[model samples]
Target: MSNADLPSHCDVLVVGAGPAGAACALWLARAGVDVVLVDQHDFPRDKVCGDGLIPDAHHALRRLGVYDEVMAAAEASRHVACIGPRGGRIDVPGTVAVLPRRELDDIVCRAAVRAGAKLRTPWRFEAAVVEGDVVVGARLKQGDVVRETRARWVVLATGAVPQALQAADMCKRRTPSGIALRGYVKNDAMVGRIKALEVVWHKSLTPGYGWIFPAPGGRFNIGVGIAHSHPARDGEPAKMKDVNLRKVFEAFCAHYEPARELMRTGTLEGDLKGAPLRCSLAGARYSRPGLLVTGEAAGSTYSFTGEGIGKAYETGLLAAETLLAAPGGVPAGTADDVRTRYEAALAALQPRFDLYERANRVNAHPWLADLLIWRARKSERLLRRMAGVLEETSNPGNLVSVRGIVRVLFPGA
Candidate 1:
């Protein structure tokens, strides 16, 4: 967590030591690659996230060899208490847990450092070091002291922030696809009352959904996310909806009963904070010349659920896998091959992101949630499939497709 450990050159330069960058550095270091991980902020920093860990998150944690550690520090839940627009509820079973990004990210970053990755904090990526069209490394800054570190390849895991991507000219979209607001609450009275990770869709908060996930120590990570929440018109790119997220959070508290109760009974531990999201594998190119983008930088967040920790972890591993596949795990001159393979690995996950986008229709139409939950109360198969979405074993498209409407209309069908 100090600039003192900064390397002169490395096999890979990983910018932004969040889950994605940390995970990539961990994997590469474990594989004996000289990876240098840098971050703008110091350790144990807070990030705006819902902190809801689903099955995919667990899988990725296991892959990183931190499943037990993360789980041990997390609050385990048996089901997600999904409430509909009309207040109908269904407890969908899944492997769910909650852990704040502050602690979660610290663990990943420490793991990478322990794995032999040189971690340098307060070292912000200023721009990529370009040799003609290839990105050989980056210029990093810590206060007024700037350092130029070269690498065979560069990996950008800068999360949803746009400055680094824009500086590196890796940003395809100037604005974020979605915006979210979140805050923490601590109340012992609600610990047993709010046992599950709760999600609600209300018509008043259109194009967005709210989540209240219970963490350990009588705390709850509460938030709402909206992906525009729009479908682009004509050939224009997506746009962030011009609504005050504070007003949205107020509306979320007004419309939802549990949110109101939690607000009324619980102590707000911190001020409500907002963050932008890059979703659906859009916004930035996966690779360019000797550089690769992973995690939220490459839009690893899902448009539907806003659960990204899992995909973020997976993308970093893929970046490491791609590098490891290269000869000597550092194919310095094979930018074309590296780009093709790394981008292809990202493209393979696109269909799932698309399916999640289909499910985002429920956010725009909360009544659909009422109908689905009502029907799910009767049809066990539909409910099981709903659980599959949380488990990452089934397509979310099945729940919102045209035929899905027919099933919701006719439960037995």
Candidate 2:
């Protein structure tokens, strides 16, 4: 059958089966919309990430009705340890689950499927078919077959890959400011000692940090992400991944007591994959006409830690809610009401991660790390402030005074 002959055109078409796309599809399906989710790859696909789910991410999973299932299916980590230079360190007691991106994506995609959404795996978006001023649908390629599918609304959930929605002509090529490298490790040697997550903060890796997150099935995901302040310092003209991630990991592992033991028997597999980690958004607006952007495409990913899944899920849920609540029923031809309501909900409901983003930038400074760690050792108040900052708490403003006190103690920092 030809593209037009396809009997099942969905009410909403979601591109990219990442967290943003899957969450959006799941939310819409739960709302009784004919949602079709498409991804370039099939289920259990891997994405480069630290692989630790923060509390906010946990809450988002709960909203999608698969939190327990995810936790059960994946390896779980409960505490976070922060490593610093000068042998200064701190451990925050909290529950941050660890699941490989492949498994996590499958869990979310399955949730959407259970909610009555159709999932088209191995289908990639080629281009959008525009009708006048609105996006009508997309031209897709499935292996050797090419098809044009039409939908009422198109949700762009593709992360970092801006080519599909290039028709919008909105994405600006900002300076390549930050660089990230990550990979996975597998071993059974240190199964009992590996915590949920570990972060190493050091001058060797400035503006960014290294992370070790243990997953289920005796596998660990570990990598380092660094932000290059000056373009002159850009490692090289080569791909971003070429920056010696193994050297960085080895250096940290040699010093870290736990990692040193974990590395003895574990195999560090795969090359270091790198990408531009945008510290600031090119544009934070969510929707335009018949098109809507969710998750990293809209720059919803938090800069402090590369944690976007939770925020992406919330954005997807909001988008679905807005579409369902629009006056005169959901818009059938364009994406107007959905865009407006989604933007409003995002601003009002989700906490802005900008502050932590700024703090991460400042963390590049050596003295700042020393001062914070010193103060944390001296005062539980300072430790709480540190916790508040990273956790992105609603009452984080409450810790500003303690932060000020620490600032006064180390004026130069």
The candidate that achieves the highest TM-score relative to the unseen native structure: 1
Q: After superposition, how far is residue 307 of candidate 1 from its true place, in Å?
A: 0.6
- Tens digit of lDDT per residue, candidate 1, span 35-147? 89999999889999999888988998998998888989999999998898889999999999999999999998999989999988889899999999989889998888889
What's the residue-level lDDT of 139 in candidate 1?
Answer: 96
- The 10-residue segment of model 2 with minimum total lDDT is 1-10
Instruction: Tell me the TM-score of each prediction against the true structure.
Output: 0.97, 0.86
Over 4 Å off in model 1, which ranges? Answer: 229-232, 235-239, 331-333, 411-413
Which pairs in model 2 have colliding backbones? none
- For model 2, the stretches where C-alpha displacement exceeds 4 angstroms are 1-8, 174-177, 228-247, 250-261, 276-285, 332-334, 347-351, 394-413
| Model 1: residue 174 alpha-carbon error in angstroms | 1.2
Q: C-alpha displacement of 206 in model 1, angstroms?
A: 0.5
Residues 1-413, candidate 2: write the lDDT tens digits: 01123224668888888888888899888878888888878777778766778888898898889999999977776577766766676776566888888788888888898998888867778887789877777788877888877888888887765665464544554334455677767887767777648787777666667777888878887777765432443654323434565576677677666666666777877775766544334343467667777776766666666666777777677667777787755545336666677777766744465554555543466455565566677777666666665566533333233556446486455
State the C-alpha lDDT per candidate: 0.89, 0.69
